[model samples]
Target: MRILVVEDEEAIAEGLKFNFEQEGYEVVVATDGHEALAAVSQTDAEEFALIVLDLMLPGLSGYEVLRELRQKQVMTPVLVLSARTLSEDKILAFDLGGDQYMTKPFALREILSRVKSLIHRHQSIRLSTPAAPADPAPAAEQSSSTQGSSPGRFQFGRVIVNFQTFQVSVGERVHSLTTLELELLKYFIEHQGEVLSRTRILNHVWDEHAEVTTRTIDNFVLRLRKLIEPDPSKPVHILSVRGTGYRFLPFPSSQDVTDEEFAE
Candidate 1:
């Protein structure tokens, strides 16, 4: 697999390239965020398996690089390796769609392990190429299970999501969702019409040991709202319940049209 190493420090970048190449990975070293972005956008450039990004860069900061990548709907898994150890830094990275994170002055072994894990997880989901959106289906009537395996396709309001392919459509717009985004949305769909606490979502979807705070959940919800809600400022499908957690209402009201009626 090919990996992009975006680090300005010469020694560190060379060391990582050497180690990753030894481990059977084809590594491309980009000394700054601009180079990394160029590598990704250039048509002849090869598709990368993963990216090891650094926050400090010459022309563009790693944060800007990651944000632009996600904004363009590039779902390549990114592992942030930065010196910023603050919780807020990590939170912003995740909010901007980073897949994994690690601090600098890092050990080579752990980096290799995380890179392998991220690549494996991303491939498991296939970061699929866009296909024709499937015919919209009625929302599931059964309760979404918190255990066992995740279900496949789900439609609510005008949104149609294929959990298997990571393809989603809202009205006429389609989106490529990150793995975490897909997981969180699936959890909401499974428990449709039920109020889910931020804590419970963190535990079930993020795992109990995840270091993220409830604010991360709020940010993710906001991102999801932009995709599925008609007016994010006045959201109807995913509702906020005062001081309690949020709720997912598949059919928020009587006047709303079924997805089938709006099919093209």
Candidate 2:
């Protein structure tokens, strides 16, 4: 697999390139955000299985590069490495569609582990997606009633989620959910009404060597609430269990109770 290493530090970039090359991956180095953008644009977005990005750069910030990539619908997995260890910085990175974040002075072994895990997960997701039909069906024959209500869809409250497309419709606004958010939500849906601890959540959602704090999970849950809850401050679907972690109540009482409420 090919990997892109975007870092302004020449020594760090060279080191990463060498290490990734040693692991049998074609490594491409981009010294700055501008170079990174150029490299990504010049090649097929899927040509690189993963991108290792640094926050500080000479031409443009890593945040900007990430934003532009997502804006262009480039869905390649990105693992952000930065010296900025602040929680806010990490939160911003994830919110901006980063697949993973690592604070600097990080171990190379851990990064390698995360890279392998992310690539595996990404490939699995891609493989599981059903391909389009070889013969096209006429638009007139298509059914609108079951358009977004497939088996891969989940609807609750004012939210309609199509897991296949990662498209979420909340009320009148439609939003594209990040991979982590979608995975977290899928996990919650699969284990509805069960209280999940932070450790379990981390084990399930992130790699074993992923350098993320429990508080980061809380932030992600908060973001999920903002997307699904009518009022994020007073969430009903993803309820907090006091000293414990969280409980996923797929059929919250606030909405009209029905046997066919949760995802089928």
Candidate 3:
């Protein structure tokens, strides 16, 4: 397995590289976010098994790097190591598609364990399912009858999602979804109408070794609502269960009303 460690701190970066190398895994170090992005671009983007990312960097902030990577649909699992312990910071990291996060003074053994677990889980998922094509046929070019008609595609209200391509469309406007957003949407569709607790979501969507807070889950839910809900202020699809968690209603009551009601 190969790992990329992106950190501006020389001592910390070297220590991680050394420890990871000792475990028989190849390690590459990048002192800044730009260098890290450059390295990923130069190599096979999918070749690296894991990435150790730091939030504070010289060239680009970790948030920017993470956002760009996800924008480009790079699915490499990222494990964030940062001194910032604020819930907001952690939430932002997860929202930007980070797979795991650890505080600055984290134990080396724990990091190693998390890395191994992430790699194993990722490989298992890949083996179980066909990897998405590097560049799928554009959704617009597909036959109208086949659009959102296959098992891999789904439609709700005016929104259409192509799971295989990670493409989402609202009405006629197409949008690119982050990896995490796509995963969460898929989970919701699979468990439609079931109330999902924050803990349940965190366990299912994030790395098992990740130290995630429920607040992070809330943030993600809010973002999803913005994308899928017709009126985010009065959400009818992703309904909060008061003290419980949230429920996903694929066909909300508002959309199910008769034509007479709509005419009224």
Candidate 4:
């Protein structure tokens, strides 16, 4: 797998590149956000498996790089690394469409684990629903457990997602999600209530051959909640796991389920 390491800290950048290469990945190193952006533009989306970004850098910041990339429709999964650990900072990264984020002072083992997980998750998504496979039978009642048999739409509470059209609706407003966001939401619905780590999301959502971090996952979730949650500020459905990662609270599956139960 080919991966990009974008960081101004020479030692840190070199360490990541060296370690990633040792793991049999092809590494591309960028010293600043501008260079990283240029690398992204020069490379095709299907080429590199992932990008590891640093928030603070010379020329442009990591946030800017991410924002611009998304604006230009770049979909390469990105893993953000920075010293900023504030919830707002993390939330901001999510708003810009980062796939995951990680703070500084992290262990090499943890980084490796995250990288492996992101790659695995992405591979799983690609495999799970291969390009609208041949029709199994006439369409009928569809449930989360039943693969590909429902009308394109799934509705619960104020949320509505159309699998065939890849559209999302929250309350009365309909919004379009990027391919990554759509896939992430589908995965969330399939495994609701489970606390998932950054590694786990990356393994299932991003390409398995890609390199990413947990922070990227947080960012994706933030973006997701902003669109789906009744109020992103006091999100009830997409609960946080404090310092760990995230979990999804599925809609009531039984009569005994309560509102709090559906959200918590």
Candidate 5:
């Protein structure tokens, strides 16, 4: 697998490259956002499996680079490594389609683990997805798994998720999903209607080695709501269980959601 590490600090950038190379990955280092973009654009024939980006950069800011990548439909998974620890900063990264965000002064082991997971998961998702279908799946197959497809599509409400292309169709709007978003949505679908605790969701969706909090799961759930729910403020498919976790109802009815259990 190949990885692109975009960081202005030469020491940190070289350190990451060495470690990743030792792990048998082809690593490329970009010291600024402009270089990062150039490397990405020029590598069409040999696509990168993952990107580790630093928000603080000399050329275009990390945010600008990320925005441009997503705008251009570059779906390479990005792992944002920044010193900024504010909740808004993390949210902004996710909003810009980052798969994961880690604070600076992080453990090297954790970074390695995250990189491994990101590449592995991305490959799995891509392999599972079929080429775009000629016709929309039949209704009966839509609610459940596509009768005999590998990692078939899943539907709830007016939303249709094409796992192969990582696209979610909600009513008339279509959104390209990040790796994290795709996996979480799949997890929810596989265990629909069950109240899943934040910890369990985290450990299962993200590996147990991930040093992240349950709050991360909540942020992702909030993101998913904006995509799948007709009204995010009043969710019907994804419900919050008072003090527990969340429940996904593929075909929600009046009895499936009570006033007391909708997500915040």
Candidate 6:
């Protein structure tokens, strides 16, 4: 597998490249956002399987580069690495089409795991989609694992999800989400139209004995809001339960919502 490492810090970039190369991956390094964009465009077309992007950069910011790439329809999966661990910052990155975000001072092993998981998940999603008439069924069948999964697409206000593949598409850009995001989205899809409290979501999604704080849930919800909400600030699909929690209003009709208001 080939990967792109985009970071302004020289030591970090070199260390990552060395580690990835040792893992049998063809590694490419870029010092800033402009160089990162050029490296992606110039590399074997769409061959760079993953990108490790740092938020702060010299010439162009990582956010700008990511937005530009998505605007140009480059579907390469990106894992953002930033010193900013705030919820709002993470939300903005996701809104701009990032697949995952990690804070600075992070362990190299964790980064490697995330990179591998993202690439594997993306490959699975692409393979699970229905192929064109020219393609053979046997090859497609061989690509996906028929494990614990369900059929039928998950629908909620212009969003469609394939549970088996863990694929989600909003507007036209298909995002390759991390494992945690996929699980959370699946839970919402399963219980659409019902208000689910943070406590309940925590127990179900993060395992029963999880000691994780509520802020984690909030961050995850913020990221989800960026994806499914038409106007995330004034949500429509995923509605706030008001001093309580949240509700996933699935496939709400025009009658359920006003032209300017969120659905009932």
Q: Which predicted model would earn the best lDDT? A: 5
TM-score of 6: 0.63
Candidate with better TM-score, 5 vs 6: 5
Alpha-carbon RMSD to native, per candidate: 7.4, 7.1, 6.9, 7.4, 4.5, 9.0
lDDT of 4 by residue, 24-137 (tens): 999999998788888888878557777889998899999999889877766666778899988777778767877666888888988887777665555544444322223223
Report lDDT (Cα) of residue 60, candidate 3. 97
Q: Each model's TM-score?
A: 0.74, 0.77, 0.74, 0.61, 0.83, 0.63
Backbone clashes for every candidate come to 1, 0, 0, 21, 1, 0
Q: For residues 69-142, what per-residue lDDT tens digits would candidate 3 score against the true structure?
A: 98877878789999999988998898887877899988988999988877776655432222221223456654
Q: Please say which candidate is ahead in TM-score: 1 or 6.
A: 1
lDDT of 6 by residue, 105-214 (tens): 88887888878877776665444423111212245443233312334345443566664545567768575444456667767756776778888888776534322446
lDDT of 1 at 231: 83
Residue-level lDDT tens digits of model 2 in 1-264: 999999989899999999999999999999999999999999897799899999999899999999998888777889999999888898889878898999889898989998998888776653332222121335674444533234567665456776666667887887766667777877776677777998899999887766677887888898888888877877777887656687777546544222233221
Q: Choose 1 or 5, whichever is better by lDDT.
A: 5
Ranking, lDDT, top scorer first:
5, 2, 3, 1, 4, 6
lDDT of 1 by residue, 1-264 (tens): 889999999999999999999999998899987898888988433278888899989999999999999888787878889999899998999988987668877878788887887777667544332222222233364233311232456665467786666777887889888867877877776676666888888877663434478888888889898988898887777777656677776656543223332211
lDDT, model 3, position 139: 62
Q: Which sections of candidate 4 miss by over 4 Å? A: 130-184, 191-222, 225-264
Better of 2 and 4 by TM-score: 2
